[model samples]
Structures are given as structure tokens and as C-alpha cells.
Target: MGPKLPPARFVLKSFMAESGLEPRLLPHLRVTNAVEGKVDFELDITKDHTNRLKILHGGTIASMVDLGGSLAVASKGLFSTGVSTDLNVTYLSGGGKIGDKIQATATCDKSRCQYKTSIDYRLTGNEVGMTLAYTSVVFKNSKGELAARGSHTKYVSKAWQAQSEAFTLPEDADIAAEE
Candidate 1:
């Protein structure tokens, strides 16, 4: 990398706050890394996330693909809001059991004021290399994984350079905590 950039955690947090997703996913979503055109996020599969087969639910995987890809778009500092235009996911393996770790990695292709992002995700169990899910989301910002991945897209708005003029956070804001 030529030079490191700000983490997407703040951007995601902002989105979460504005969209009121904190109560839903803040406990699980974590920005592992964010810089330039790359963003990484992860979630641990818990008892609350299991499905009928006692496996990680498909919905959880889709969440990953949405959030993961959005981070990539946010990191570019282009759009304040990244609206998912489309999404696509694929399930390679079952996310069996609880206490599993699911990681999503996102990369971007930047243009004038927009970014095209793709997120690749994998879920791992304690011992077994559980393919809990594998997915790729072509997101601009709106959402998250395989266990959801096919074709996802979004529309993003540019951010203000001035902190004072930057986006505002809501009362029950998730991004506020990160900012």
C-alpha cells in the first residue's frame, strides 16, 4: 500500500447509527481492518444465530455480505450514504453449531465519486474448517454474506472534509460511539 488511510469502523458505525442497526448488530459486528481500498469485518456465530439444523442461519451470512461490502465503499470517503443497488451470495458449507467465527473481507474499485466493492466471507468453527458460508457482495454501501452471495450493488454520496460539517449521528447512534 502506498499510504494507510482511516478505518471504515467509523463509517460503518455512522451507518449503523443512522440506520438504527446498532441494537441489531453492534454486539456482533467488528471492524478488524480498514485502509484505502480494503475493509475487513467479523462476527462470531452464537447460540442466538443458529437455525433448525443448529447451524449458523442463512440470514446471518447475508448480513455479513452486506456490512462487509459496504465498509469497502465507506472507506473510500466518497459517499456519506452507500445504498445497496444489488446483492448476491452463495453457501459453500453449513455454519453448524455456535461459537463460530465468521470473517468478511471487502475490496473496492474507485471511480470519480463512486466505488464498486466485493466482499468475500468465510465462517470457521472451533476445530473444523466450517464453511459456515462463503459469499461476495457487489455493494456500494447499504448492507452484508454467502449464507445470503450473487450480485449486490449500492449508491454512495460523498463525505464532507470538515469534521464540523460532517454527518451527524442520531440519539441511539452506533457510529457516535466509534467516532
Candidate 2:
């Protein structure tokens, strides 16, 4: 068997609590798998997520693509604060219908970067998996047929606040003291 996967609900809950993303932004998404440089997510298509035609909304799919890519980058355990410099999605088939399960997997490409060749080569296979690269996310329907594909280029911030520890306020901080 493959590596044991964490509970999807727990992963999502922890990610939201740490990332501070509003629950409403990704109410139906669940993290099915998360490992260094890779992440997978799933969503059950419900009436609430459908368009007037009773099919999953394109916007919803696009949002999932973005979320998948971001989470994949976060799996590296390096930086969490980043902005998508470019996102492109191509719909390969009709959107899912209500009651359908849509699955998405995001994989970060470690070799794609503008850095010097020698340094970039060295960065490969590093424990941290840090690299300035693009993330590719693929969405599939319940039957495992391709639904959409997305490419996201993210600029991970190197600022101090982007460190993982920054997500948690110090116990002695003013906010904690006030509380």
C-alpha cells in the first residue's frame, strides 16, 4: 500500500486554522493527501456548487485549481505566503454534476525556474524541496476521466513573515497578553 494518508477533514481543518483562510472560501474541499511538493484534494459536487444548468460551475473548478496548487507548494514546508503570478486552466470535459466527486492532484515541478543552472541543479532533491517553479494541478471526475488541467506559477515570498513559524503568534506577544 502507499503511504498512509491523513484524514482529509483534519488536514483541511488544520490548514484553515493555520493559513487563516475563511471557511466559506473552501467549504466543500477536503485534503485527501499531502506530502512534500504534492497535495491532493477532493470535492463533492452539490447543488450549491452548480451553475444554472445544474453542472459544477467553472468558477468553482478554477478556484479548486488555485487552491490545489497553493497547497502543493505549502507541502514543501518552506514558505506559505505566495502570490500566483500566472494561472491557466483548460477545461477538457464538461463539469461534474451534483452528487459527483471531483478529485484533483497538484504536483510542483522543481526544475522550472529562472535561477542559475548550477544552483538550480543543486536545489533539486533537496530536503526542503524549495524552488521557484510552476505547479500543475489536474482535476478528474468520479469515473477518473480528466475534467480540467491547470498550471499555476507562484512567487513564494522570501520575507521573514513567510516562514512557517510566522503563522503562529508568540505566547508573549501583545495580542496573546491582551487575551
* Best-performing candidate as measured by TM-score: 2
- Per-residue accuracy of model 1 over 41-125 as CA lDDT, tens digit each: 6666677666878777777666666666666655544435345666667676554457666666666543332222222212322
What would the per-residue lDDT of candidate 2 be over residues 1-179, giving only the tens digit for each residue? 11213322333455556764425556757666666567777888888778999998887887777777776665544335367778899999876899999999888766532222222323345222333447899999888899999988777645223453423322443311000
Which segments of model 1 are wrong by more than 4 Å?
1-6, 109-151, 157-179
Off by over 4 Å in 2: 1-22, 112-122, 126-131, 159-161, 164-179
Q: Estimate the overall C-alpha local distance difference test score of candidate 2.
A: 0.62
lDDT of each model, Cα atoms only? 0.49, 0.62
Q: Candidate 1: lDDT over CA atoms?
A: 0.49
